[model samples]
Target: MDVWDLNLRHLLAVARIVEFGTVSAAATAVNLSQPAVTQALSRLEGQIGMPLFDRRHDGMVPTVAALLLAPRIDAAMARMSSPYVTMSRLRALLALADVGSYAGASHVTGLSVPSIHRAVADLGTAMRRKLVERRGRAVALTEAGVQVVNAFRLAKVELETGLSEVAALNGQETRSIAVGAMPLSRARILPRAVTHFIRRYPMVKLGIAEGARPELVEPLRHGALDMMIGALRDPLLEEDLVQIPLFDDVPAVIARAGHPLAGTAPDRRELARYGWVVPPRGTPLRESFERHFAEVGIEMPKVPIESGSVMTLREILIDSDFLTLLSPDQVSVELEAGWLIQLGALPPELGRTIGLTCRASWRPTEVQRAFIEELAEASAGLPGALHPDLSPLLG
Candidate 1:
């Protein structure tokens, strides 16, 4: 049979039978008699030239063909049901048009009067003919208007339902926020921040991921991440990114409590005497350390153990004489527990700035903007954290 000959009612009946597992159950589900449901299924199978279900001892089992056709049938029914869903809306619009009452249309459609006028105007434009004609204060539909209204009546319900679903999905509660950070930040900063943010707005969904600065910049640039908080490496700061310096994290020498330098304030020469645990040579921290030591007339310390994992470094520091430079935040728990001790004063120049970064053009949505405000407030009283300097940019 051609597409138009396919009966929506019969297809619905077949779907129900397959869903409910028995003719009686299907009939009850669709508010029809068992015999009526069976007949509808039979007619549908006959129209398609295939048996849609097999009557087994267990229940009504759908055939392979029926299973394959079920999705299409459901989709067709959904589309067919659309116009009825919006019928009241279309009818009210038509009534208002007939009576020349914009206010009445607004009330009936639950839209503003201007929006009602715009919708009618848009419909007329789509039809390529005037649906409504105004004479003095009165409005009436033309011949083309009657035809358009009749056509719209068939699908208005479906259209309105689809639009409403889309609008609901686009609202603030349904929106997802993308957050990217270094693994350390994810383990430390993000958990507490996310907990606080969610406690206030439980409906806002969060998409959290962690990566190094190199791995994060592209995603942030492509609009994949709403914001990132991590070490502010210079190479990652592109023209498109807006970087806000949040705090300075100085790399301090960390070692187990009984290590040689634990109780001593080591001078630059004394620090260089031990084997070090450091990041790879080309990294920002490593480079910054080299620059600072060079300025202080000290040679770069030999790193016998190089690593990227902060946790691994912590483990080594807690159990070995290996000395490593680490962010105070990473070693805070160990330091507090007396498992590790700060060896010496970290030079002011060895400090790295951690920041909140986003796309330069990123305009925060109401929810995101509010969350950022809270983040700013929460970060304020953090010891050793500094407020962002905006005076230069503002000027």
Candidate 2:
């Protein structure tokens, strides 16, 4: 039995059963009779080749498979229940979101103004909330409308991914992965893993977007990115995001090979004497760098240039004595090629946890999970790969 054979209502019944823990209660939730719910559960179990629940005198207990499947089912059903409930309505909403007016949506979607207007109105009515407001000749979504549009957008991605997963099972490839690459990830981890992933899954398309954490977080959250691989936040800053620790990003103070600071561990004041190329303010690296100095009661060095680019920092350091803090992994090639010198590692307390970050609600497809496995393999021997002291924190 194929999951494709299960309708939305059937999946909803499964989720409801899991949530309510009894056939009668689940039937109440999904507006089906108890007998109908029981039958649907039976059919769903048969189709999936697994018993989602174990019947006992007290209640039905969900299996591990049911627990894992519940999130995807709930997410997809949420999309189906969004204000733009059908494809036509969703398309109209999306068009309006893009163009900001019913007439513009009509022009873009090749839908009549009345059709677009009715779709938007119906969406608002379905959601029991006003989505758009007219201001002069333009239409603008209210806060609630923006949220609904974002949900619809995610739903579109989810649907496409579902199709791609189905195609993969049939020995067909119709998938793409978008990765948000932070500085350390772009330098080694992501590139290496992507090369390996492509060699193995040649049919799957891949996109790599490089940016700072602040730049990538929104896209990662919005479903524009499959996942982000880079420095993990200490205490895991974003509640809506989940971080999987891969390693520790222990930064090093670096300078040119022949610089006066080479082979010498300078004190904080002496270190502050040199001009620096540091990460932009508010970054984890920058915060760590500042904390190191603050702990020693010394002001941060004069920033001759601020950048997140490893290459830029390396070139600057190579040409002059501009000290900067970076993960040694980020400048491994340059350091090996005799272009840069690592002055010293940051104090043991000053490292960032490097890892994978994704939306907390995200459910990886088989291919995406495979890619993550590839990433883990590629990052195996990376420097500072999750020190023992930090293992407990990660665990």
> Top model by TM-score, which number?
2
Full-model lDDT for every candidate: 0.65, 0.79
Residue pairs with clashing backbones, model 1: 82-158, 83-154, 83-155, 83-156, 83-157, 85-157, 86-156, 86-157
- Per-residue lDDT tens digits of candidate 1, residues 1-395? 33334444555677788788888887787677988888888776665566778999989988765664564445434533332223333454565654577777777556687877776776556546777877777677788776555444323322222222223333523445778877446544566777888888788777877766667767676456778887777666367677777666677777888998766777878878777887777566777667756777877777878776778888887777888777767878888998888876477767776768886655554456656655555556665567775332232
- Cα deviation at 243, candidate 1, in Å, is 0.5
Local accuracy of candidate 2 as per-residue lDDT tens digits, 1-395: 32334555666778887898888898888778989888988886665556789999999899765775666667776765642375577788889988998888989878999999998899789889898998888899999999888877776666566546545554667778899989888877788888899898899988888888888988887789989888877777678888777777678898899999777778888889989889888778888888988897777678868998888888888899889999777888889999898888888788887788887777777668778887877777876665223222222
- Residue 187, candidate 2: Cα error in Å is 1.7
Which ranges of candidate 2 are over 4 A from the true structure? Answer: 1-74, 80-84, 134-138, 257-260, 387-395
True-structure RMSD for candidate 2:
6.1
TM values, all candidates: 0.53, 0.76
Top lDDT prediction, candidate number: 2
